[model samples]
Target: MNERMIRLADQSGRCDLHTHTQASDGMQPPAENVRLAREKGLAALAITDHDTVAGIAEALEAGKQYGITVVPGVEISTRAGGKDIHVLGYYVDPQHGLFLSRLAELRATRAQRNEAIILKLRNLGIDITLEKVVAGIGRELKPDESIGRPHIADELVRLGAAADMRDAFDKYLADGAAAFVLPPRITPEEACQWIIGAGGAPVLAHPGLYGDDELVRGIVERSAFRGIEVYHSDHGPAEEARYLAMAAEYGLVVTGGSDFHGARQGVIFHGDIGSVTVSVDVLGQLKS
Candidate 1:
């Protein structure tokens, strides 16, 4: 963070514990995210990109240059009870061999899902393809980089099939939508195992988005979770209150974040960086 920006930040040193980068589906490069976090006067920001840690190295370097603490993190996509569950892992060893291998497998599954979505779109006369979406990305995806529904949504917007990413999800890519695909994947329990296996702190990310408190509670109550995202850009006061009480009930670390994924077609995915945050003291609890 810039000196003035950092100085202007909340006196308590606020941290946004969730975010994405181009290494995943986010539009910004890892360095750019750090720079923005600095400009926004955040004490720290986590690079919790989906299924990969490719962004962490760059973010860490940027963190050093900008004097910001960049938490190495990943958001693992899992399935349970017919729902998509996301588990956020913090302070992971980005170069862990088994972790990398497992993430590669998940990326392959994601690629397959992307292909299936493309096929479904084609069948519906949408005329979009995986090749086109990759080409539209303007650069080749690295081994650890990922492509998800957001990329497909961008292509749909380009093809005029949808006005924006939100519309694309509403009409086709979201769960239960026309092109939605729910392949059998690991459960949240397994995801917790994966995170803990990598010596990272696993946090249940944005529980309110799941819509089923029972399923959310199941993971929180049963998994080896270190924290709960009690504060999120998408969460209302009631949702925040519910999760805060749950965190207290379970003795879990209380965390918060903006879940920033950068702007897509002039719309920010979840939130802007620093829009929702918690005191940086939680970083210590997470590390412990």
Candidate 2:
């Protein structure tokens, strides 16, 4: 964690804008994820599942039951300058036509890609079976849901093919790694436009992960992004400062979160909403 983030977490702020649930790739189910969020004492959260809002409804219901605020969301993967960029769309309309269609297409592509990955793993003598991976989706994941590498990684661990999620990815699943699968998707601008059409705030997620400063700035300048995710597990102090400065220059909202998934995932939240130290006022700015 960034030192400044540690200081911010100490300040007792409000809201964790990014989160995940089993509706996408998270280990926990929506209800369980919400319960953990409540336990963490977050004032607000967004279940930004990858390419689908399937988890949001359940998360929203769970949040309501637990007296926590749920901000409907999805994390879309898109290409910007030939590099993959993920944009988090928050407070989205779940029923948006284009959004749903695009997600459906992406999910279909994911299934095919997963099959290819499984075949590649098999060829590599990894002992990974597609049936095992499919079975690892858990009961809460939908039939039409996009299966992520995390599920595959978990299956690998379960089947003794790999030690843990990180090992599985490092050995096979990471981009450009052996058995890596690519999804056919739209550009980052299209993703931003899709989110805007869904009446949501489109924010670039983890700019530090892009590894290209010029590409990062170009994406921000070209897209209708409402915010930049400065607070993330991958960002260091220098990267956070750079992103926060960029956000300010672009007149965008600055949001942060624990990016919490569950226990199996390495990092855990130290402070509830206070972890990022972003003011509760950021939510108001998002609405505007």
Candidate 3:
């Protein structure tokens, strides 16, 4: 366990391990997310932006300024049994060569997927363009930010084709919807290996959201993941207990986070920083 992380956790009684920033689909920049963690009285915050570590540096800088501990992390999207599975990599080296190369390839794949979705939408007479979608999202797409269906949904809303993001996803962007495009696939095992290779702890993210305890169990049994996210904002009391039991059964580390995405989705689904409680001892257990 890192003594510094242990001390921080001991002081604040809470930490958020899963969070996003504008580097991906989140609404705020990394620094702002760190500042919010400080305001929320959190001892530590992890900037687990989707498939990218571009936000970690800024978050770390902001953490220093705000007196909060920033855990360097990334959320990797992968597939298993045709289902989307997300792996959270904590304590990652952002500059790892192989990791950087894989991220670039994933980003390129994401761009292609976005283009295909737009073409499908146009064929369905939605008449949307990538430029319009970018404009709708109100930000120039950064290299670190992978353009995904959320941005497309934003475009749909801007065009008055849908009332909101959820509506847009329901109508055209969700899996099996008209504009849906299958994402590039990587296995959960491969994802875990990558995280381990990068000298980080790989954790299964939001098992409850995926609706398959068996699949999560299969991954844990077959792969090298070090932890499970036991305290997600979306996890109910029952779900939390279930994962907690699983963690103990597997001898895996326990982690919790708000999955904060800022205001992009309107209401924050996970409670604010201090609200979702995970003890410092659990944070210590995550130390490599």
Candidate 4:
């Protein structure tokens, strides 16, 4: 660890277990995100970009220069009870073919979904185009890699439809928003199995937000995942307490994270890695 990192750890500081970069739905690139993490004095971080490990290599390389350890991770969007749920996978082999194949399929689905969203928005008189979105993305993405809402949000900002990405999500992109379109998704149990099969620990990203403790528990009991996120920026104090207690009672590891997605998600960006205050020891426990 760097001196700044050690100091942050000594201060009862933060460690963000979840984040994204331009390689996924986030606005900032991985290298810039690492610089922000170092500036924020975060000790450890993970780049849990949606359904892909494309950002991990960049994050790991950047972390090395800044004295932070980057967890190889992904945030997979899956379904349960007709609602989308996010599963966080950490310390996985990026080359795991099972994980890679599933992600590839998801990315293809995401592309189809994005195209459909664009068509829907056009029909709704949004005056936006997919070409505009691709242009705003400003990077050459591989054919199989996913370009998501953030790219569209960027296009919206560029087109003067929204002041910023958050505005775009609020007015158009987020669930229930005007441009919202639900994509095909796998069940949470299936997602957890994929993560476990890839030799990673699968943790429920934010169970408190799911609002179905009984159902969530049912899935948890059936899956091989060993943990739940008990602390998060979007979670209330009461919710965190409840999740922590539930995790303890269920013999599940309790984790925390900031869920930072740069400016794309509206909240202020904390460190890309250290916004949750998770101890290194807690991260170590996941290895077992």
Candidate 5:
């Protein structure tokens, strides 16, 4: 009966639990993401920017102005099985010193990866420099913000080194690409511990993307994750069904989101703000 009531209430509103903003690699500012959610009629949004909570303050302020709830979140990058993995933390205390310190450490790894990619591009005669990459961004990145591959990709295209972001990634930045690098980093278990320590709920993000159910299963089994992203822009019906079952088997809550990063030259990254969402009631579940 309780679950049925929750479902009935969810029909009235929804939340997008995954998104990015310029505080990380996204093109839009934090407040703009909130405004977009308002326009989309979403009851809530989460600013799960990469490795930084710097965007959360502005997003939280916008939530009040725009009449939407912003979930304080971060997408921590991790590595396992020779692949990149991301863990999303919701309701984390943005001011937690240890969490900030740990995120800074992760950002440092990202810097190393970026420099390695730049070196590889230079070796390939692309001639893009880290300084040039920062210059092309039109503004100085925040102290907590580090250069991401997408920014590098944009600089490459701006320099006519690549046709587009996709081209830039396919040839240089994506996994298995010539310039790709996966430096050593914390495990997903450690990330989960970070989130838990910061009084946040950790959720496994985009399980299907891993291409290794065993890895996903191991993380779910080993970590203190409270939820799984059963619905995502990249997930198909089959993938969703599989993860939905996985969530049920693990007694985990299901969260879904568009993973919005705004459009670039008429191309939206994963999807638009409301392209995929879950019942707004799920927000309460995450908080609990």
Candidate 6:
């Protein structure tokens, strides 16, 4: 552990267990995310980019330079009850062969979905292509980066088909829209198992936002999750209280984060980095 990080943690009790970077749909790069967390006085941060661990090495390297603890993490997309579920894995081995193979399969499926969405948009007389979307984003999709609806929405905005990301989604890219395409995903149980196999702790991400308490309960009962994200930028006091009670009842670790994706999508909630404060105890629990 870095001594400076220890001092910062003692002073602020700041630990953000969730965040994103350009390894996926986030606007900033992994190093920039680390720098931002350091500037904001965060003692620890996790780069839980969607479906990819490509950013972890960079984040860990940056963390060493910044004297902040960077937890290697990934947020996986899973399917449950016809709704999307996200499972966060912490302290994962990015180079684990099984995890890498599974992620590659998911990314391939994501590419297929992106192409299908583009075809659907074209069929609707809205001309767009995967290349255009990549170009609009100003970066080629990295090998491990999973193309998502946000990239499609950005292309739509560039093409003048929609005013902005929300407009693009409302017009043709969101679920039930003309250009919508469901990508392949593992189940919640499989996601938890994968994380365990990769030597990580699996946590339920943003259960309050799912709006299905029974479903959340069912996952907790059926899966091997070790933690619950009790504090998030989107969770209100009531929601946080309820999750806290649930965590205690289940003897699960409690985690929190800002889920910051940068300024492109605007303010997510409380503010940005340092928005949702987490206890360093949570990090210790996750590591153990």
TM-score each candidate.
0.95, 0.90, 0.92, 0.88, 0.95, 0.92
Q: After superposition, how far is residue 226 of candidate 6 from its true place, in Å?
A: 0.4
Ranking by lDDT: 1, 5, 6, 3, 4, 2
Q: Which stretches of candidate 1 lie over 4 Å from their true place?
A: 1-12
> Residue 177: error of model 5 in Å?
0.7
After best superposition, candidate 1 residue 264: deviation in angstroms?
A: 1.0
**Whole-model lDDT, candidate 4?**
0.79
Segments of candidate 2 deviating more than 4 angstroms: 1-13, 265-277
Q: Which one is best on TM-score?
A: 1
lDDT of each: 0.89, 0.77, 0.82, 0.79, 0.88, 0.85
Among all windows of ten consecutive residues in candidate 3, which has the lowest summed lDDT? 2-11
Worst 10 residues of 5 by lDDT: 3-12
Candidate 5 structure quality by residue, lDDT tens digits, 176-287: 9889887878888999999999999999999999999998988889888999998888988789889999999999999988889887656898888877788888888988
Worst 10 residues of 2 by lDDT: 267-276
What local lDDT score does residue 206 receive in model 5, on the 0 to 100 scale?
A: 94
Give per-residue CA lDDT, model 1, range 53-106, as digits (tens). 999999999999998999999999998767899999999999899999999999
| Model 2 Cα lDDT, one tens digit per residue, 4-47 | 64545543336677777777777677777677667766666778
Best by lDDT: 1
- Better candidate by TM-score, 2 or 6: 6
lDDT of 3 by residue, 1-288 (tens): 642234235437677788888898787889998888788777788899888998988998998999988889999889886688999999889999999899788788888989998999899888799988777767676767777677778778878888987789898988788788888778889989998898889999999988889988998899898999987878887898899899999998988787877654475634555445466566567774
Cα lDDT, model 1, residue 160: 99
State the lDDT at 107 in candidate 4.
91
**1 or 5, which is superior by TM-score?**
1
- Whole-model lDDT for model 2 versus the true structure? 0.77
